[model samples]
Target: MTIFGEIAQITLRALLGRRRTLLMLLLAAIPILVGLLVRANARPGPVDVGAFLDAIVIRVVLPLVALVFGTAALGSELEDGTAVHVLTKPIRRSTIVLAKITVAGTLTAALLVPSTIVAGMLIAGLLNTRPGSDPITATFAIGLGVLVGSYLYAAIFVALSIVTSRGLLVGLGYALIWEGILAGLLPGSQVFSVREYVRGIAETLEPSSIESIVGSSAVAYAAIALVTASVIASLRLAVYEVRGGE
Candidate 1:
């Protein structure tokens, strides 16, 4: 295999081998199962699928799952000294970071996107028959939002792991406080919020009457953040101090 592929493969295996993969899978199921239950209950009211996608799936679940996968992909390796083995290889440090983040982002999307789609579909079925809204558009928008959100967050968390041993705690704080509470409540802070960027992308696609905060500019911001994080992570890995497996 090529260098990127090799690193990606190892990262994927390491992530999947952990019990957290199963836990993430179960977490992904939450929206799907809830949608099914809500559908079975038989109600022709305003389902507000867009709201659910914003508040629950994208805001809460996507970040949580990305936190686990992104940090663990690199954090555990660095902590246990396995990362030193990869670092010793005659490979570009950027390539190593790229591979690991790629696998993490891909795996995160694979896990969360389908669940978002299925849940959207269920909610669409429940809400479509009512009136003025199109659930398919909402579902497509939410799916795209989840995709962008997952990858962006993965890149960021990967960089965070490189910078600190307490990356998980830091990531959780960013997710809960910075993105979750501050971003939503403070208009000025939305400029720095990842969730707002994700929601902006979704709103651009489907025009949510409720969560329309940012514009297409959100996409630009997200792209910039992803690239910046990836570059910083590569730089950190290049000169990273290794304790020889401690």
Candidate 2:
């Protein structure tokens, strides 16, 4: 089989693994549940639809979910020595890493895009009931921002899974400490945080709402930097034996 074919086989085999299936199903449900809850309640408030969606689902929910699934994407394989099966294949080591990253990133994007949309519809429905608001357009924009941001970070998270055995713990720290707390307080730190970038793209959906929190040029550059660096690191690290399976 060719590289793409091999990749497809690897991806499908990996997805068919027991744990990944459960993870996929659970991840798919997160946004749906959130959407249902939001649509069921929460009276309309005087906030930009993009900003509100970003604060709740984009910034908080998606990142946390990405950390969980992204890390598990390759991290579990490494921990269990399952990655050895792929590494020993006829394909180049780089292909193994790329294939795994593809699976993880694609799965993450699938979950986040649809889930965010579901949640956005819920939010939009509530906002639509109010006077003088275009919740659908704003919610649509928010979903776009979240999709871009999630794809970029999903790649980074997949790479990180290769480097660290404790991917989950470190990923959580990256999400909470680096993106959540420190990025706001420190200068130049905006270059590292994915949350800020998501917020920036999200601000495009509503400028004034998140202008105070996330910068435009800075967030854009940050997303590029994070994705590039992570890709490079993962490609390089793929040379090493992941778990040295027997």
Candidate 3:
């Protein structure tokens, strides 16, 4: 019925943009490839989850995907001035924000779960190849962590895309500086880090299989704060103006 509504509809469609579509595929493939590599080298049994999660998910994949999808959901459109075309309508800005968030969040979650599972299976196979560790639980634990963590991170970044033009650059700083450095090196910062919560949830879900980086309650609160703030902030930042959001 309106410009935002029509464009929102386009973005919501699975095949709205080819560039974003290809990026999503590449993102999904990373985890799967890692899983295959691990499995090929060993057997799918018990996995060395700490090393795997730290190196694969935390160190590399998650942040990169967050940067790409989060920015692409809104930043790219803003940069290209395409956002102006849509905002020229009668639709509520809140609806447009929600639509963008939905697109980015869905892409992250849908791709992350399967990739984590595949990787976990491979790592587990390797650890159990010698017949000592419990590999079966590894897959479930990692998959569980991937699911919620992806959702949390995606939502946070999707909202972030609104506040900054350099979405990927800022997201990189968020991942490397906040999540990677400060959270890892300082216990004090852990209280405020989103990853702290993800690590906690992952541990809670994996209970016997993995040890979380922080306490459960702390992580729970941090996760909720990140998600809620992202949504609320994005809503407030909405500029109903048709041009430059001015």
Candidate 4:
């Protein structure tokens, strides 16, 4: 437990450096800032604020931030050879992977959820009449969905980081091309999409307000995928050949 705590602490410090922390704050604040500006400036009329928020926050911002933090958690260490010392420690590799996952997931959620809730509230307020889902329900749904997405995405990216130096770029391609475009366009792709898992949860809570292609049943697959990725990551790191620093 102590070892895990140390790894988590180190991971947090590495991932949350001054510039990166500022970037995360700015990324999270995107939705809130945009929502406030819209609320203040846009003329009063019937608008689908929920859908707009969904597109911007869920589809775009959430994944981008997750990619950044997730890759940074371990990928940076691997690239810079700082992880060699940690790898040589008398600790289980799974512990290291778990710690990285925990920190990355927590950090991503912390950065994302508040902005989502605030943006949801602002959008809910803008609407003169409530929709199928109440503001509270919608806010909860978005927060929950983003939380789930952040954890799952972070786990996958952390694993990718161990396997490849270009994990961030690969994650970006997957997020933009695979999950973002394919999942929406190809029904078959929904089965393998993390976004669908997130949408499934949100839609289960507020089916009308949240747009989802797959039903709640798919959430199990998402969980399984997350676990599989973590396990694979641990195994990879356990036997990883760390070389001298560059």
Listed in order, each prediction's TM-score against the native is: 0.94, 0.80, 0.80, 0.94
Please state the error at residue 190 of candidate 4 in Å: 1.3
Q: How well does candidate 4 match the true structure, expressed as C-alpha RMSD?
A: 1.8
Better of 3 and 4 by lDDT: 4
Stretches off by above 4 angstroms in model 1 are 127-130, 244-246
Clashing pairs in 4: none
Off by over 4 Å in 2: 16-32, 127-133, 205-215, 218-223, 242-246
lDDT of 3 by residue, 1-246 (tens): 755456556666632468866876787788778778776776444457545765677556776775677667666777777777666666666666666766665666677767777776666655453244355565576566666666666667766667766667888898889877877787777766666665666666656545555756745675577558566645754652333544
TM-score of 3: 0.80
Residues 29-90 of candidate 1: C-alpha lDDT, one tens digit per residue: 98898888878985656778888777668878899999999998888899998888888889
**Which ten contiguous residues of candidate 2 have the minimum total lDDT?**
206-215
Candidate 2 lDDT (Cα, whole model)?
0.66
Q: Where's the lowest-lDDT run of ten residues in candidate 4?
A: 127-136
Provide the lowest-lDDT 10-residue window in model 1: 207-216
